[model samples]
Target: MDTSTGPDTVIVGAGVAGLTAAWNLHKAGQAVTVVDPEPGMGASRAAAGMIAAVSEVMYQHTTMRTLMTTSAAMYPPLVAELTDLLGHDVGFRDTPTLDISAHPGDRDYFSALAEVQRAAGMTVERITTRQARSLEPALSPTISGAFLVSGDHQINPRRLVPSLIEALETSAAAGGPPFILLRRRAVEVLRAGEDATGAVTGVRLDDGTVITAGTTLLCPGVSLATVGGLPEADCVKLRPVHGDILRARLRPGRPPLLERTVRGMVDGRPVYLVPRTDGEIVIGATEREDSFDGVVLEGAYQLLRDAQVLVPGAADLELTEILARARPGTPDDLPYIGRLDGVDGLVISTGYSRHGILLAPLGGHLAAGLVLGTAPTEQDAGILAATDPRRTADPAVVDSASRDPSNGHRTPRERTAP
Candidate 1:
């Protein structure tokens, strides 16, 4: 398979990150081609598309908070562009989110959090448990405290993915765009040198075909461990955090399960429940760092169990599907996004952890800007530097033993192995 003449950019992984990059680059007049075996099947389709910034911010993730908030601010325009191009709505809605406290004793903590967020100029209102239940009637009356974040919003990622693919194909067919979607899995980065300094010319798919492109962006999501040519240490360290998400079809006259994308802290762990415009309530995710990729875990069931505990009506809803998705997580929970140190023409865009959906648009925009040498904003520049692969001590390191293709869901066995 000869892939001699390459497109302007070849993106690996068709998840939200790769799609967003291709879209932004195409809009910027750059030829782009995207490759992924799963395409719409991977993590992108499994995302809950919650654009909750201030409400979801963990104390240690200030940088992520900045990027998430900034990118979230761009949602209206971005959603409008895609919706117009697709000639349909992607279920984007700006309903305020309620961060409810499941335990009565945690009211003070929730109150403090709300106070801090409000003082930071975020649009969150401290609400009583009654107000919280009023906003989301399905919520359990057991809620003790809640904070309403007016800026938090949500979109159906399932709908958004198809819409994006449609827009990408449309642009390509019109002959004004060079975005191509190749449904194949990338096995390794094609390089000339044995060292990381060797420039990545393209990629070799699982099949015999070799795609040689000028630039390659790694957006393989949790599949990052499967890619060759990356440092072995990095792969070993790259953990797949599993999230169990459940989808439920709304009953007639049930009212909205959530006015906005709602998140709750139960037992000091975070869980989010998002309601889509199409009357599907998405409740997810238990965060466990495991290798259970592409499989549903019991934790997902527990998510619903816990969700019902927080929102009593959840027990009455019909569950349509359960998704066990892997989020590429790091020790610090920050994404390793930036240009690889020694590999030229190869950029790392994976490792977004749980924020992949919310971070997609801005990550694509800034990455494309970096590649084109266009002027980036102050914040963009800082993020690029922080996520650079060069910051890692060694770039060419590879560990075949560390690659676990087993269920990417975290398991008790693997948990104690490392």
Candidate 2:
């Protein structure tokens, strides 16, 4: 096998988390090489990209609340920097999110959740259905109740991913540390020694070529377990949580279907409609753990049916695409981000589950800090502790329902849409 060495860091995935970390490390003058068979086509491409901090709150995941809110606060500056560098918009919207319920039970569910949100210092305002319809005339007048989260926003991952790749390319062209993209799957992680105590050297690609670097950051999402040479693989305990997402477009000259994102609980199932600056509306999603990886017909039907309940205009929008991808979920729903216990020169940032897009900035920041030996702030220190790779490894404490803590009644296949 051919071996080469020069890159300071090797990132094993090109999704939002890996790309964001790559960008941060490149800006810090680190020679970064990103490895992925297809860049930005994994969960990042399938995400609806709702940066909802307040609206995404759960009952007991307080650490997630802190991480989500902190990351949401970081988006404006990140988007502005990317726009300045690329000289164009990256599809970030400051539009507020509207939370609505289609049934009395749904309303009660959210009311209790809203109380929890307020207790956590989040902004959730109870608004009348009439007021919600006033904000977006397309809203169904029959909605049971509504709440507005002004701090919640969105960014189109489809646009943001390409922007990040372009920024990385521009940095490479500017003659700093070279940015390399390897369109190949990493089959094995190379290490300095044979035992678990050894430091990570780099990775061996499927093509029989090994690329060595000082640090290796694994952001392979759900495929983390498949990669070899990791002592902490079992301890990470990443499971594939699949979700079905749909995309639709407004008819010609139809005006916008809705100005802001609308999340609704229809018959106890959660769904959301996220609008783009363009005339496209993203509707999704269904969380499932079945063996089938493709889009489920029932999930699509449920999303479309519930979408129409929130906005009748949704019935007229032409369906554009339906996609399904598996997100890496942890036992406790919090992501695993930090160095491995006995492995040196290796860092992992995966298991983001449904909030990958919302958590990318924080994940990237934390992963880059770990690589550069930069000390995290006191707040970040606590967050790091919460996301430790070895925290929830014990099988006795693993609970599938831990993914959604707001409602214990929710099945393993149901998740609150952010």
Candidate 3:
């Protein structure tokens, strides 16, 4: 844990967010250290990597959709940058997404939503089910309506993770080093001062070694709560929402199983199927709230049953792999990012629900810009303002009261545990 070169910034978790932040920090001439228990096996690996903003829009809110659309647009440039940095193609593909409906009610709802999105200046085109099937022969004839969103696309999240890792490794390989990828667990944040209210100095490892830094970035997916600095209520409130998906190996003579990211409402539930250039058909996602472990459940099996109604041939295909991973979801289905007040130098960028992969570039850029002294651009500023940790701060606590609860409040530490 003792190194001659002290890190300017310490980033926790090697998921997309952490890696992206490390990349930005390194580019900005800041000495960064990225610490994570696992490299490529976090939530980023479990993501389908569908960058569908319009197709995946919420029924009520457009804020997330707006952020997603902007992030989706930024992916091409980001992917190009990563590809150039990594010296390899990371499977950044520009493929439109289709949101189709099997039932009349779902089709009607989609038709209305399409109009709403179009009126809002989004590029959405309505197509008949037959026309949808014409674009991709695997689509079920039972599909009543579909909307083609031209701005949406997909990338290989699995490939992106390793590619970023390689880029980091390459930068390390060269003598010009900024961050060291410490493949170890971060047990807790070390707080300085009498009230334990000063800036986060570093993290303690399970092996009893301490690595200190000026700034600590917590990008650990579901494990963000395990860090000791955060309030027990805030920490314990963060739970995992498990999603199970199936990757089908393609056979010869079968033209792609899915042309683009095909999302549909089957039995009043949402299902998305993404096709990769390597002839892999990815059919996803059963969102179950109660599951903590990453074991595939019966609900995931039922997902396939529902998906086959949209694409009947899916059942006939060989199941390459069944992926079950837990997504870090906040109660309100939004991400928690930005600097916390109590802990001076600790920043969190977790609880990204399901759009973590699609939103990585912008999220990383904003988080990195914040950690460094560099002023964020107007775009980054807007996003950072929305996700600022101060938003989660208790408004009742004023000035010095907000800095540290342990000294201000006489409540025993035992009463604070959830």
Candidate 4:
């Protein structure tokens, strides 16, 4: 590792949230050094990449709804800026999303969910199955209900991560404060005073290299508690909520199966199909808080079986990949994205869970603003408060459960819309 020591900020993870924050800081003329063993190979790579603010709303997550919608609105400008800088598309698609239900029970569930979405000021319109089929001819005719959410969109996280890396590298090459990506695991965060009053000086890598900076941002995802030298790390309460996702490509000469993203409720379980321009469709995901780190047979079978029910053409597609990754889940299902208490120059920006891709821009902006000493607007201030890392709560009260001793994994947790 280079012994240089003037990076304004040091980021510990290079996932979407970390990379996005690095890009924002770099664009603002701040030198950034990102430390990660493998950048973008974590949960960000496995995400289905749906910008589903409108379709992902739940019954009681009002704070999450506000964060999602706000971040959804920020995507266009961020994409445009990234495209202008890179001189190419980063795989952001403004296509609408269709919410459909297969069974009568599923229809009833969505009908109630629509009320919650509407109450949060989201645009959702009920459409007949005929109308849905008219828009997407390949949809199964047996679908009992449909709703059009034109506000929801999709992006390719695979592309977004590379673009951010390229932008950061380009900036570094342009002769300013250097942007460094240290290919090493951060072992500890170096602090300058007592545990209760210390300020973050930099991070100590696994090999004992210290990269000093003015501020240190922790985005280590599920490994937050394992990072040494942070006294309050365990208090953040992060758990691994694993999910299995799949990718399939349309066979040659086959027309596109879906024009946009299609999310559905099949037998009361949520599943989604997101289409890309290059004849690929992403199907996902089965959420479980299990200890199994690899793709499960039952989870993969369920995704494939349920996807075909919504779009029967899914059965004909060629299965290309199957992956399993754990999202960093919080007790309340909201991310921790603010300054750490009693630690100066240290920002905590992990625990995004399933919404990491959807909330990247907002998380990046807030994290960078915190480093730059920029005051958030009134609207953003409320979101910052809701996501404050120091907020006190009992982690055991949530819907998640401990790992089962009989089985290798825990019980299936409640599923949320993708």
Best by TM-score: 2
lDDT of 3 by residue, 1-418 (tens): 5433358888889989898888878877778888887886878888888887776654444456666777777788878887887778897889788887878977866777777677667889887777888998898887888888878888888898888877777776775456688888888887888876677888887666687888888898888767775562263235687888888867777666787788877656677788888888788887767775765568677668877888888877778888788888754455667776556777788877678898888778878877875687786677666566565455443234324432211122211110
TM-score of each: 0.87, 0.95, 0.88, 0.93
Q: Which portions of model 2 show Cα errors greater than 4 Å?
A: 1-3, 194-197, 396-418
Per-residue accuracy of model 4 over 175-288 as CA lDDT, tens digit each: 856799988999888888664348888988987788899999999899887678888666688889999999999999988889979999899888999999998899999988
Among all windows of ten consecutive residues in candidate 4, which has the lowest summed lDDT? 401-410
RMSD of each: 5.8, 2.5, 7.3, 4.4
Clashing pairs in 3: none
| TM-score head-to-head 2 vs 3, winner | 2
Where does model 3 exceed 4 Å of error? 1-5, 230-237, 252-255, 393-418
Write down the lDDT of every candidate, Cα atoms only: 0.72, 0.88, 0.74, 0.86
Best by lDDT: 2
- lDDT for model 1 comes to 0.72
Per-residue alpha-carbon lDDT of model 2 for 1-418, expressed as tens digits?
6878669999999999999999999989999999999999999999999999888887666677888999988899889899998899998999999999998989988899899899998889999999999999999889999999999999999999989999999879978779999999999898776554478889999988889999999999999977998866678888889999999998987888899999899888899999998899999999888857899999999999999987898999999999999999877788989977778889999999989999999999999999999989998998998888877666654553354453122334335533
TM-score of 1: 0.87
Q: What is the clash count of model 2?
A: 0
TM-score of 4: 0.93
> lDDT (0-100) at residue 415 of candidate 1?
31
Candidate 4 achieves a global lDDT of 0.86
